[model samples]
Target chain A: MSTVLQSLSTELADAVESAGRAVVAIHARRRIPASGVHWQPGVVVATNHTINRDENITLTLPDGTTAPASLAGRDPSTDLAVLKLAGQSLPVASLRRDAPPKIGELVIALGRPGPGLTASWGVVSRADGPWRTWQGAEIDSLLRLDLAIYDGFSGGPLIDAAGRVLGINTSALARGVPVTIPIATVERIVTELLERGNIRRAYLGIGTQPVRVPESLARKLELKSDLALLIVSLESGGPADRDGLLLGDVLLELDGTAVNDASDVLAKLGGDRVGKPLAARLIRGGQVKALQLTPGERPTSRAA
Target chain B: MTASMTAGLAQEVAAAVDQLRQITVQVRTHRAATGAGILWNGGEPEGPGLVITNAHVVEGERATVELSDGTAARARLVARDLRRDLAALEFEPGRAVVGAVVRDSPPLRVGELVIALGHPGGLTGAATLGIIHRAESDREGRTPRWIRADVRLAPGFSGGPLADATGRLVGVNTMMQGGLALAIPAVAVEAWVRRSQTMAVS
Candidate 1:
């Protein structure tokens, strides 16, 4: 038992030592952080390729070694990609668990900002499933970190004391605090990427608008909740349209679950709904109607 | 025409410029200032006047006219096509006004003499002389005729008439090339003015 403990201690120390030295700084040109609010401390996260990959890209490694890295793959819809690097024994950061972290827990970040390895320490500011970034993009799993995040800290790793990656440092707070992607979400994304090349999302191809029913209108309509989803536009030949969903219809529920917000419908439509028949309830002209819809394959907008 | 014929041609050109003074209106826009000349009346020279200008001169404004002699008149923007960057304006009932004689065709050839007339930089009457450098059949596939010249037309000279050596209106001075000169063919601009008039009448 004493021998095993000694061996484990030595291995852990070696792993830390190797990882600290192996984490290299990456820099690509014309790939700038979107806004200040999403800035993360100590590390700069950057897109390895330009928003449009046709432009030239420059990647710099730690120790001032710069080279060109080919654009691995990017999903236009998701705006995520894997940039291929040529080096060996790259220090891979471990992902955090999918569960939300307890509030007030300490979080740290390690990033290759500019020319050196930078570290930022903060606490888990907020753990919300959905919060919008400064650019009007809704971050699905947002873990706000309490740190003054500057530019060049994007695409860096937000980690914990155990060296587990809590999330990918994405942006800064509107008031200049840093924000990150929750580890649980990143882990699921990694799993999905390993099994499938991209984030496999299910779509119904229907535009929805939030209906904030007035108190009098809700009483007059005799609704359970004041919230309703007004179907705005239905894509031609989409599953929703084929299932008899029409414009001006107000959606009530999906698969026996009431939907009070647009995110609720989206959350239910995540990977599980792929090729699955769903029960959608709608109120058209104050008459409730249910339709059976089997989701179709999401439109592929990529070369591969 | 020969210089002997043009001996009176300059006087006639000055007279034409004098007649155009009634229709030569000052247009003030948010970003720039320009002048436009109206060909009052129809082919018979006895109908409501029509304002002619480079389309860029009067963009995005409710039509209103200001005469060079300083009388403001209410006008209506008739038609605008960006391809040619030319626009027309229609006005209410007005008295007899002078109109130019359109050249039967584009300029004869490169080095053919031409005179540009307008208010360069808002100066009342400015004229520059230069020979046509190149006569192209088409510009961006819209107007199939354009003349590139060395005569300089300043910012305020757009929509001013470009007359041949014989003093016949041949083009509507449009843009300057590196402080040089360029004009849209008068026949094409007249066609737009005519088409716009027909639409306004109907």
Candidate 2:
């Protein structure tokens, strides 16, 4: 009477039962509560978009007890927020960080929108290399699911068949499409957010748009590429403005890398690049000009 | 070994679906499209069989029930409960039909596999597989109102059987809500059937 089908069902149920121990309902927003994972000791990880207000946040633990939680920090770029829970002996999520989830691998999304723990199973639809989000945060890996996302699915944990946490699921990262923030990215963000209460990135206060450089100008400037980014706006007294970089400068290269798109510029603006002077090559007054522009730490509230 | 195990799983699922299809019947009424019905009770020799479906599927007192083996018969509505969205129909089969084997003990677990057989979009015997989304806790020794599942159910899937992996009937697919399929637990349906049959006898 022992069949693979029955064993599979039992194992799946066992996995949900084991993993549901760490999943809790986060009451941070209106309407139905969202899900969060007890990631580390006294720490819970949830989605930033689900936390509507920072004050008066509470959590319904796996044992069906309500506990007050304080906001530790939030990183909107990764759609992750950390909360500090006190004096609760709850089990932490067992994270599978050694290997990334493969395409077509069986996975389950566990959430506790209310007192009940809900589960939905499916396969990993798309698993690709690292990709950048619209907010310029680089996710460690791209994980697109082929499962039904229920209400309060955001901030829930996507667990493997063995009941190990693969990543945190969020519907806000990919324009409402369900995507998981992998453990590598979550670990990095959790460390940084817990330490500094926010994520830091290097920013140059200027907006750029890709423009086709005139062939005559390209040939005269000895530029290798015919396309360059046109600096359209400059923030007053900002990093680029303070470095004497003018408006309408056709940016050709930054730190020896060709800059043909806005994302190309963002690739050079990681958190480590803050306060570091970068070699800039641009076309100013129909001539190639080189300048050392130091990048400043971006404000938490400012985009780009 | 892995390949055989996977094949075994697939074969077992196919067998379960086939067993469910035998007890599943296509219900047609003059007022609505073709829906599905479960063979609730396959009566004794020379007795009438009982079929259960959604009340919304059968508008009047009469309906046409077509078994999976292509046997068609005129059925009379025995009981209709709009509150529970359940209806019972009685039909005289030419021979003995198979009744659903409902799972009543060892309450369902969350994330346990569940299979649904329905006639979606007029398609006969369509089977879909999913897991139990949330298994309600029966603290008060009462059956939960609705058994919510993650399986997808279309318009023509109303009043079908939602069985477990081993093909035991768990619930009856009633309607869909918030993208989740809601079903009346088989135990609850059994209680309702008992009450209705008692009333009919009196």
Candidate 3:
């Protein structure tokens, strides 16, 4: 007798069979290989953290053939890396971009750690709006899963019951919690990485920590917000240092927006903001001083 | 979807678990650790009931088998292959026994729903649901060494039954590796039982 349970099982297996064709084993690191998806024609996407070395990368296709793949670029902020595969006929992942995954929706994670394709199933646990990573990259959406993660899971794809790609899975982001980098974000990064060979981010090169201004100081300075960021460290000869900003300055606003936290400063430091001058308001020598600081393009491997 | 559809799926799963529980038995040796076993037919239409468990779970020549109805029986070790980590126990069938129905053909597919019945943490007849992590290779006449699954299995779950969605036995839950449950495929177990029974008759 046909039952709903059997149908569910068969459909799930069919989904895996279809989606798994795009999943390939990436042999970039030592020991067990990681996973990568055939995102587009001649383009593969994987996790940045899993690619230990920049060169000498190879891939195991679904047909058990080994092919050399060149690393196009990597963005540590988003934990994503794009690789260029030449003359390969692998199928591209079918992406679901019209709608975001809902909470409690059944999802499967597919990985090709070895020649065999592995799968794990679970429900989407949490789905929220865009969030920023510690590296300052803003993910399109926060997709937390309730599934068990395994080896090579970092660079795999989180697929739905229909076998359509939802996002790229990564354990490096969110402090070891499995998070999916949505299709929108992946598409944006893949395009930029393929073009520029790296992600361009704006940086002030100054470290700040949130601090509470004393009520007496706040009243004297006529400050609008009681909380301000205290400049703790400055990169020598960096943008902030070159802009005449001191180490002990209390930053109150940037571009007329209140700067209460470090992320607030990051919110204004996108790639488009790199060569533009920003208005900064800070309390220097116990006096409100205004300065125009132009952010610089953050060099690769440098933290703000 | 109506409430009845959801309930129908739930009922189907519950019924599959019920069928699996009847074929599952608790295996206890002189050791402190307890494991589970599956009742087998011993290749005879009406012969003494046979229990299949892990060789690691049954160390001595004799171990105690407890049926689903809480009836205990003394069983003698009939066949053991340490390399395969499988052992067969023969016990008198004081009453009718339900043997596991093994799936014969059309090997497992990746992502198919599977159910595992075990006695984890001293809990009897506990069931956990998962999907087949990877299907066996399609090579003819060759069975994969282990059937890896995504199910969570504890120490007490060894020698239990890993059934498909329809409750047909697929593998014997043996050990866990890399957080994935590895099972001995039932087809291999059936072959071993046949060969072992032949050696006993010879």
Model 3's number of clashes is 0
Q: Across residues B52-130, which tens digit of lDDT does each residue of candidate 2 receive?
A: 9999889999999999998889999999999999999999998977899889878999999999989988689999999
DockQ: which is higher, 1 or 2? 2
Query: What's the CA error at residue A220 for candidate 2, in Å?
Result: 2.3
Which digits, one per residue and each the tens of the lDDT, describe model 1 over residues B1-202?
3555446545655664554454456555553456655453445666666777778877774456666656556666678888888877766536655567777654344334456767667676566655454334533345555666546567777877776655567777788755446778777777777787688789
Model 1 CA deviation exceeding 4 Å by range: A1-22, A31-58, A67-72, A75-80, A94-102, A128-142, A161-164, A172-177, A212-223, A300-304, B1-202
lDDT agreement of model 2 with the native? 0.91
Question: lDDT values of the candidates?
Answer: 0.57, 0.91, 0.92
User: What's the DockQ of model 2?
Assistant: 0.74
lDDT of 3 by residue, B8-55 (tens): 988899888888999999999884547999999844537698999999
Comparison by TM-score, 1 against 2, better one: 2
Candidate 3 per-residue lDDT, tens place, A193-264, comes to: 999989999999999999999999999988899999999999999999999999999999999999999999
Candidate 1 root-mean-square deviation in Å: 25.1
Which residue pairs in candidate 3 collide? Answer: none
Clash counts for all predictions = 17, 0, 0
C-alpha positional error of residue B155 in candidate 3 after TM-score superposition, expressed in Å: 2.0
* Clash pairs detected, candidate 2: none
- Model 1's alpha-carbon lDDT is 0.57
